[model samples]
Target: MHRLELDGITKQYPAVRANDGVSLRVKPGEIHAVLGENGAGKSTLMKVIYGAVQPDAGTIRWNGSPVTVRSPAEARALGISMVYQHFSLFDTLTAAENVWLGLDKAMKLPEVTRRITEVAHTYGLDVDPQRPVHTLSVGERQRVEIVRALLTDPQLLILDEPTSVLTPQAVDKLFVTLRQLAERGTSILYISHKLDEIRSLCHHCTVLRGGKVTGEVDPTQESNASLSRLMIGAEPPQLQHGTRPAGDVVLAVKGLSLAREDQFGVDLKDIGFDVRAGEIVGVAGVSGNGQQELMAALSGEDTRSPAGSIRLFGRDIAHHGARKRRHEGLHFVPEERLGRGAVPTLSLAQNTLLTRTEAVSRAGWIPSGRVTALADTIIRRFNVKAGGPGAAAKSLSGGNLQKFIVGREIDADPKLLVVSQPTWGVDVGAAALIRGELLKLRDAGCALLVVSEELDELFEISDRLIVIAQGRVSPSIPVAEATIEKIGEWMSGLWAPRETA
Candidate 1:
């Protein structure tokens, strides 16, 4: 019997049809994949099912009976729970506290903490119950979300880009947990842009495009290319590798060490690396293993480092602020796109003025025309599908916002660029385009430092790679000489320097 069913789901927004006559069903013990590009209606449809959004027209059947899921509480009460792509966590609250607030049950703080620990242990999603949400790394925060969803013991669970922030080991653990859940008669609605993951984990898939269902197939029976064709109507262009040699070192970090700012945050040890002009250096690591700390030091978000630790063209810049660094032709694209990268409440046009002051008046006022023109250029050039330049940053889908931010920085023609998770939550087409753009920037003599969890992405665009483990960095090695096994081993802090060898 179908565990959940939707028919004729139509959600109409003022600027777009988020979901247009979409329909799908899930069976008990089924691990169903909802496959689509960004803004392709998969999220909207999932929201409709979970009661986060109300469809203008649709019939939702629960266990063979029609029902109206009026709110998240109602959905949860009906044995449904969801984990969002962008976390909805309270920065001020601890992990246990956040999870406690989500549930309808009343439990003592200690009891809730104990339950959290139990769930984390059971599911292999390690989380600290006492760590404040803001203090947690992106991957840890993701674990909080997953653990919370699992705690509900819902018959039907909805996971949106669930593994985006997790390490390979953590992802494997999650897959095992998901498989176990499926075997226990709990159905899963998995939403992700990782096609390989879907093929491996999902038994069935529903493809969507432009707010409509396009096809249904058993992903295990289909190839990646076939799935891409179904979802995007064309094969994504492969990013071409470069043949250029690296130039003089544009960015160098030597003996970079800093105490953890937050009580639960990771401390940077004697970290070191270098990025040369005309080459992309990829930093590989588990999420919490000092990437955030390192990004902060590099981007001038946290400048508590020694003056000589970070050098931009042989000049100490640890004292410079983020804007000052940007002024020096150093640009950064943060991993957290919503708040850190783009203000949600601001219009796209206004956000353009955030980094590019040229979009403002001579007196520093936001010039509407110039801002709009700049935003439009970025949108059009990046192939970002959004309402318009005047649309709020929160209005566009996650991928569109990412595209705009990346395009904004790339358009500036920076001498050095530091980007973290450049393709998180982005579709295959957008990822390919973005990766291609990064390579193109490198060819233009831009020194690029990339920090990513996807090993394939690192191999694709990087000329050299360094593994960061437990706040310490391994020696940089040429990409051609790097192996997944070597990088994977070094991710645990086991690496030897070439000079030492």
Candidate 2:
């Protein structure tokens, strides 16, 4: 029997038809990939299947019988579970507690913890069930979501952008886990914009573009170029990297250390780095290894460092606030887009007000026209898809939101730029465009610091690299000298200071 199927699915929003007559089928024990570009409606279709959103028109068939899925609880009861790209777990809860909350079957807290550990070990997920969700790395948190899904033993499993934050090694481990799940007769529906991953791991691929099905193919028989063409109607642009000449130091951090704010927080220890004008310095580590703390410190969100710790153009600014740093020609794009980087409830034009006062104001008076014009320029320059500047920040897709956030900072023309996970959850085309913009900025003499978990991205764009592990930063090395094995070892907190240097 077919494990899961959707026929003639359709959904509509105020501005667009999100999904139009979408149909898909997954056989038992098969890994099916849903491919699309940003705002292509892949997420909408999956949400319909998972009962997060009701379809305007459609039929869902499970085990060859038509059925109605009215809510997430209903879908879960029908042996379906989904792991979203954006996590839904509470930050303060333990992994076991989060998992227990999702489950329908009643069980003791100790029993739930035991099962979480057992399943994690069996699948090579390697998460500590007792660890608070806030304390776990991004990859470990993802494992908790996966383990929660596994506990349900769902007949159909759906995963959305599952590896965006994972390191290369973690991605491999996740693949093994998914393959094992598929072999055990659980049908899988995978959604991602990474064409290569889909081509390598999925048995069948369904392409979506602008809320419509573009094509379907056996991925094993298709090339990446062909799949890209099917999904986006064109090939993604290529990114070029070279050894750029460095200028004077623009941003420098020396002997920066901080005590943990929270009881479980990671205390930064002896972190030192420098970004020269016309240079890009990449800091790489698995998430939760002090990337958050470092970004906070660099962005002026946590300005409790000692005097002379952080310097901009040879001037100490350790006590400056975020607005003061921005006024001093420093710009930042944080990792979280929804609330931290951009406000969700605000319109795109209004969001620009968060940091673009100079661009849209004169002597403390807000110029409404200039604000709209600035937002319009950013939208056009970044190719952001939205309902003009009036659209709320939450209305855009993940990739589009990321583009807007990055573009907002880039347009400010700062002397120094600090960005974290610049392309997290973005599609390939958007990712390439964002990287191209960063390179252009670097060439234009803007110093840049990029903190990300993706090694390939760092190696491709960084002039120098550093590893952050357990709240400590390694000495910087040239990109040529940073090996994948060495970086992976550093991720585990194994590298000594001498080895890093």
Candidate 3:
């Protein structure tokens, strides 16, 4: 008998039919993958099954019996649990506290802590249960979500874009955990745009396109091109990389140091780097290793640095605000898309006010037409899938939102661009496109600083690389000289000290 099943599922929002006649079945001890492009209805279907959204038409079966999951709690009670793509975590709470809130059992705080640590170790997630969720990195917080789901001991597990924030090593560890869970009779429904991961880890695959099921097959038996065709109805564009010439220094930092703003935050010490015009400098580190703090300082979100610490085109702007820095020919694309990069409640055209105020405003009043025109340009340039410029930012998928954000900054023609996690949560093809755009920007005489956990991405586009560990920047090296082993060592603060003359 199938462990979990969905038949004739259909979901309708005011503007779109998110899912149409979607059906899926997962046998016991199987890992089933749902593959699709951004905004292809994968998330909507999963939300319907998890009771986060009510399907307009469909029947759900668990263990061969029709059931109605009216709420997430009801789904949990029915031995079904889902880990959402966008995390639902309280930043102020400890890991144990966050898990305890989702759990049904009447366990004490101490017991919850014990259980969290035990499960973390068992699954090789290695999270600190006592650590505050606010202090954790994106990858660590993702582990918390996974551990929370595992503690439920559910008969079926649904993971949505689970590895989007994880490092390559962490992804391998998660696959091991999932394989173990499947061996113990736990069925998994994995949703992701990463075709290689789906093919390697999943036994079965279902592809969706325009809110409809287009194909179902064994993932291991299908090529990447075949799967892309099923999901997008066409082949994704190829990403090409070429050697770009370098120019004069556009951004330079020397002896940059700052104390922690928060009581528990990491302090940056003696950080230094430089990026030349027409070159890309990539900063690589494991999540939580000062990347956030560094990005903030560079982006002018946290401009507490002393005078002369940071220089843009030989000008001291250590105390400048974000807007001032932007006016000084510096642009930034933040990591968090919803609340940081773009406001969730605002329409895409209105959200342009967040960064492109001058472009969309005249005589101190916002021009709706200019804003719409700019947003339309972003959509066309980045190939963002949305209803139109009037659509809410939250209506778009993570990948599409990322493209929009990056494209917005790149279109401004800044002298220096600092982007964090340029393609996080993007599909392979989209990721390639974004990287290619960054390289093109570099080739066009724009200095770029890219901070990402993806080693492959950094190595591919960066002319120079630096590893940030515990809020300190390591020595920078040319891409030709940097190796994965050496960079990984730097991530852990294990590199040799500078030699004395």
Candidate 4:
């Protein structure tokens, strides 16, 4: 008998039919995957099963019996737990505190900490229990979410884009944990856009598109091409990759060191690197190892560095604010898309003003028309799916918003572009387009500094690579010479930091 089942589920939002008659079933101890492109109703259906969103019409079954899950608490009580794509963690709370809050059973703080430690060690999810959520990196934050859901001790678990921010090693560890859970009679509902992951980790797959299930198959026996056809109805785009020689240094960091802004954060120690025009430089690391701190320093979000620490085209702009950095042709696309890269409450056109200022009046007034025109251009050129220029940034799906923020920055034609997780939750086509655009910029003699946890992506476009671990960077190496084994070792801080210019 199926452990969990959804029949004829439908959910409607103000502007979109998020889910329509979506049906799926998960057997006991099975790892089932839901695959689709962005805004294709996968997340919505997961939310429905989790009881975070009420379905307009549907019947859910738990253990062969009909049920109505009205809230997350109710779902949890009925042996269901979920880890959302966008984490629902409190920034000020510690990792253990966050997990304790989610769990239903009463337990002391020390006991919860012990359990967290045990689970983390067993699953290869290393996280400090006392660290605040705000101080953790994107991948670390994801670990917190996973640990929290695991502590719930549910019979059915749903994970949405769980590995989006994980390193390759971390992803492999997660697969092991999921398989173990399934072997112990815990059913898992995995939702991700990564076909390779589903093929390797899931026992069954259900494809969603336009708020409906388009296809279902045993992903293990299916090819990537067949899955792509069922999900997006087309082949994925190919990247035009070619060699681009490094030019004069566009962004240089020397003796860059800074204390953590928060108590739980890692302090950067003598971080130094340089990216040149016509080349892509990639930073690889396990998350929470000062990736956020380093990005903050380079993006001008944290201006604690000395005047001579960071040089943009040989100019001392280390202490400049974000606006000053952008004005100097140093554009940044932050890792967090919702509030940092783009404002959630503002329309896409209005959000463009965060970095673009040419449409601004001399006295600090913004012409909405110019902003709209710019947004329209990005939407057209990048194939961003949105409800025109007036759509609120939060209204779009994660991938679409990612495309917009990336397209916005790329359209500006900056001399130095610092982007983190450039294609976090994007579909195959969108990811290819974004990478192609970055390469185009490189071919046009522009410098790009990319910070990503996905080693494949780094190897694909980066001309040189550096690894960050425990707040320090290893010696830079040519991409042609870097191997996955060596980079994985460096991710553990096993490699010593070396000077580079």
C-alpha local distance difference test of each model: 0.89, 0.87, 0.86, 0.89
List clashing residue pairs in candidate 1.
none
TM-score, each model? Answer: 0.97, 0.96, 0.94, 0.97
Candidate 1: worst-modelled 10 consecutive residues by lDDT: 492-501
Q: Which should have the higher lDDT, number 3 or number 4?
A: 4
Residue by residue across 1-501, what tens digits does model 1's lDDT show?
Answer: 799989999999988999999889999999999988889988888889989999999899999999999988899999999998888899999999999988866777888899999999877677899988988877778889998888889999999988876667667888998999999999999998888999999999999999999999999999989999998999899888858978999998998899988777788998888889999999998778888999999998898998799999999999899999998989999998888889999988878777887566678677677778888999999999888898899998999899999999999899999999999889999999999999999999999999998887999999989888888888888888888878877877778776221
User: Which structure is stronger by lDDT: 1 or 4?
Assistant: 1
Ranking by lDDT: 1, 4, 2, 3
Error of 3 at 335 (Å): 0.7
| Clash number by candidate, in order | 0, 0, 0, 0
- Report the candidate with higher TM-score, 2 versus 4: 4
Where does the lowest 10-residue lDDT sum fall in candidate 3? 492-501
**Model 2: what TM-score?**
0.96
Which stretch of 10 consecutive residues in model 2 shows the poorest summed lDDT? 359-368
- State the displacement of the C-alpha of residue 192, model 2, in Å, after optimal TM-score superposition: 1.9
Model 1 residue-pair collision total = 0
